[model samples]
Target: MRFSSRVNAGAMNPIAAQAAAAKAAGHPLGQLNDSNPTHHGLAPQFLPEAYTADPRGPLGARQAIADFINASRGRGVDSANAPAAPAVDPSNLYVLSSTSEAYAWLAMLLCNPGEAILMPKPGYPLIESICNLTATRAIPYQQFFDGSWALDLASIENALREGNGSVKAIAVINPNNPTGAYTKLGERQRLVELAKRYDAAIIADEVFYDFTLEPFDGNARWAGEQGVLTFSLDGFSKMLAAPHAKVGWIEVSGPAEDVAQAERHLDMISDDFLPMSNLIADCIPAMLQEAATQTERVAARVRGNMAELHRLLDADKQSGDGVVDVLRSEGGWNVLLRFPSSIDENALGLRLAHDFHMNCQPGYYFDMQSNGFLSISLLPEPTQFERNVQIILEAVHRELA
Candidate 1:
């Protein structure tokens, strides 16, 4: 029995698996961990009434993708700075089954065995798993936490520099999972510059673009005109509130030359996999057209729940008890909660599930070592969320005080 050195074999982490086990026990362990929209009861009818349409074929696929591109371009994006349409042609708009699979294509395109791709710490773990499974290295970059997470450019630059240019790409989750901070326009431009200077690509996973609570009217314009190769990853996942829809996309944009080369390669790869899901592709335009209203509804819910969570934490803080402090949440469904270093978030998390019967995510899973972090799904039903959050906050008060 033998295996390639790159074979991480997709082993499940015991902590998460145990949590899943507790959840599967068919009772209330106050689930605060997962961010699955369907699990939280997001209704599919909120999407445009056309989700049931099926893609006709290759031409049908092209038309479905074209509609999204045309609509996105017609959204009054500054055409001078942005492409205002999908680049490398509409056929270049390769549809995929999920963002996880998109990462696989991207990882193969960007990194070779043992080569590195920069990822955020206190970030999503899937990138690490993908890199490990594919034999590429997932290098950690610090997302500085001081009330809010900021992209540490100096550290990112150092990581690329220190790697002797082995870093092929850098991943940014616009509304990063676990931590909901969106990269600022200024930061986005800076990263593009760094990517070109380092000769690397910036893979922007923007699945949560529409769920923003505040206005980021012009952020998408940052995609091009930066002289860097940028791939914008997005799809029906969040747009339709239909995670079961199984549709995600990667749009290649940036420098004229790099865009061409990236397109040729991406198209070839897409051809090889033929990964497009006909059902999901047919549903894109309808989802886009109909999602605007639901977007507002979800954003409001996120803000209301997050505000309530913060109010409780603030009350604890005023009492000189450091229960938790939410970092500035700009956009996205989850917020980061920092607790005292002595609190073993994992152990406390298990205790909360077993003893207090509440659910939450430990900070360590996202790579926080010293500071204890807790993550809650912002998409939970309000009435139930308030009850669960009360229990979570009480548990935090007990653990940290």
Candidate 2:
């Protein structure tokens, strides 16, 4: 039995292997790498009416999504300081199971076998698997971090130029995972220009759009951008803290001809799978209307945990032997901590699990370029999170001593 090389090339990386080993050890693991809100006790309540709804989903749900995007992105408001983001049309929205499925559909729509897609380095690692599944190639462009993460436009342009026009699409995660840097307006403009120049589509994953911790000046919605075909992906996974609900969407916008052609292809792709559960689709309007309540709970938890982390780290620094430096994160559910150069991240992670009974992810899991970085979840229960942080700090201090 012969399998395709793409399938053969795709396997779980070492980080996942270590995580599994830790789980199998049956110790009381304080998980600091969790992202699932439900696991942290933030599940949403669904309406009973959802159970008997149409399989294609209700129009009301799509309209609710449009309204949520418009209001959140500061569109249709009278404020002078607000970005002039156009209102999203419900007709352009298509429901899906999750962002993972959305990526797969987009990959199928944009690329043929062996065609390339540009992704960001030090970003989410799942895109490679998505591309591999669709028989597409995932090429990464660098994002350099000084005080904050910045787009390396020269690197992106070089990637496109070097691809010889085989690059089908570029993926941008607004308020990117781990790094938590929002794509600025200038960066978005440059990206659209690059896409137009290379004749490729743009895939904007704004799943963490609602979790901004500071006042940001740029627009979050990409649904109404002109001149280039753009697919803006988001879902209930992050917005309502309802990952178990498995609801997501893609909003298509561009020149009329391009959008129409893309929609025709996407419709066929979506129809074949019909992945969105009817119940979740029907519950979307209520879920979205009540989203603030759930998101506020999550936001408060994340903020509380982050504050505790900072306070603890500050105390450690005051002790004059602190070995961890918390990286600046503008938004998102995870925070990055850079440890001393002497510590091996993988070894530290293993030791934390086996000796300290704390489960945390090493930075290599997120494609960090160095060995001393660790990514810890900000979504764990507050008390558990505090305990985990103290354990982590003690371990680091011991190592430094």
Candidate 3:
């Protein structure tokens, strides 16, 4: 894969290289120039007395994460219902502050100025902003919906062809936001082939992988993929249902040579940023201990709310010939509600917020192809969620009438 000039230009300074070698050799050297308060024993008792900087984050934290991920994926071996995937190696992981930071680092690692990364349209809206901030071109590839969403492989090939070696990576949001469609195995295989042919890497965002609603059989996590240079992203934000927890990671796997080179450059980038703090890193194990229970708790909330949404909407359709329809959601915290095209989405959004006193995101916020689609969150309390769907159904009925 073609890495950016910025990453190529980065190399360890002689002093740092020697220090690293010395540390690896178990010959600890006193740092006379160390300025960190923790290193000088001036920090509070809660903080570590010594500041040990590990570019890939502290080892203990990474181990806890790896163990958690492996256990999560190892359940129900060879089963279509659960992860049933391979184990993760802690050495292959990079613990960062958030997935947003991971995207920026990957963009910097892959694309130079004017070079591109192909993103899914009707996808995560923040990706374009991240690309723009990193000076990388955000190229869009189509994901069409018939009854369920599927990638337009031809569009992806077209983008790669047009890029002509300028495209460095393809971003796959597994069980994509709003759409809630997991990338099928066939789609994954084709994507790997495309990445190989185009000399690009795959950035798989599996943040929402655990909350399966109506997913197909044999759905799996992308973390252990070995076909191409793949970086699978997941974090506490979604896993533990705690957005305040500032912990996310990238699990790098693929061909041996590609993986090594990517990790070396990523290590350099991580060392420069030192994104994860020791205090937060220390809390990871405890947080991960809560992960399983928390995920199940949040899963129940989203799944129950989704059922409520369907119940209310289905009943309304039976009675009033409702125009609003809930799209088939396989996974994720959000679902798409389709209304008649005659009712403008912007006006509906206004009516819901202004008159009905309820807030919901218009589908265009996620770059939906047409009007009259609203992105509804499935995370609300059951009663409140039912009421919100009721208001939406009434508003759409009035609009259709």
Q: What is candidate 2's TM-score against the reference?
A: 0.83
Worst 10 residues of 2 by lDDT: 1-10
The CA lDDT at 203 in model 3 is: 94
Candidate 3: tens digits of C-alpha lDDT, residues 43-151: 8877744666778998889999988877766722565554455577889999999999999999999889989999998887878999999899999998998898999
Question: Which pairs of residues collide in model 3?
Answer: none
Which residue pairs collide in model 1, if any?
Answer: 30-359, 147-327
lDDT of each: 0.70, 0.79, 0.87
Q: What total of clashing residue pairs does each candidate reach?
A: 2, 0, 0
The CA-based lDDT of model 1 is what?
A: 0.70
Candidate 2, 1-401: lDDT as tens digits: 11122222234599766776777787545668866454655656653233312223466777788888787666656566654656778878887788899899888878778988899988878898999998899999878779878889998899899988789898998878888888888898899999989888999898887776552665455757766998988888898888897888888888888887777667667666753654666678778877778888888888888888998899888998777878887788988888986888877887788889878888888888888988888898988898888888887776666
Candidate 3, residue 142: CA error in Å? 0.9
Q: Which regions of candidate 3 are displaced past 4 Å?
A: 8-21, 28-32, 75-85
Which scores greater on lDDT, model 1 or model 2? 2
Q: In model 2, what lDDT does residue 14 have?
A: 93
lDDT of 2 at 132: 94
Is candidate 2 or 3 superior in TM-score? 3
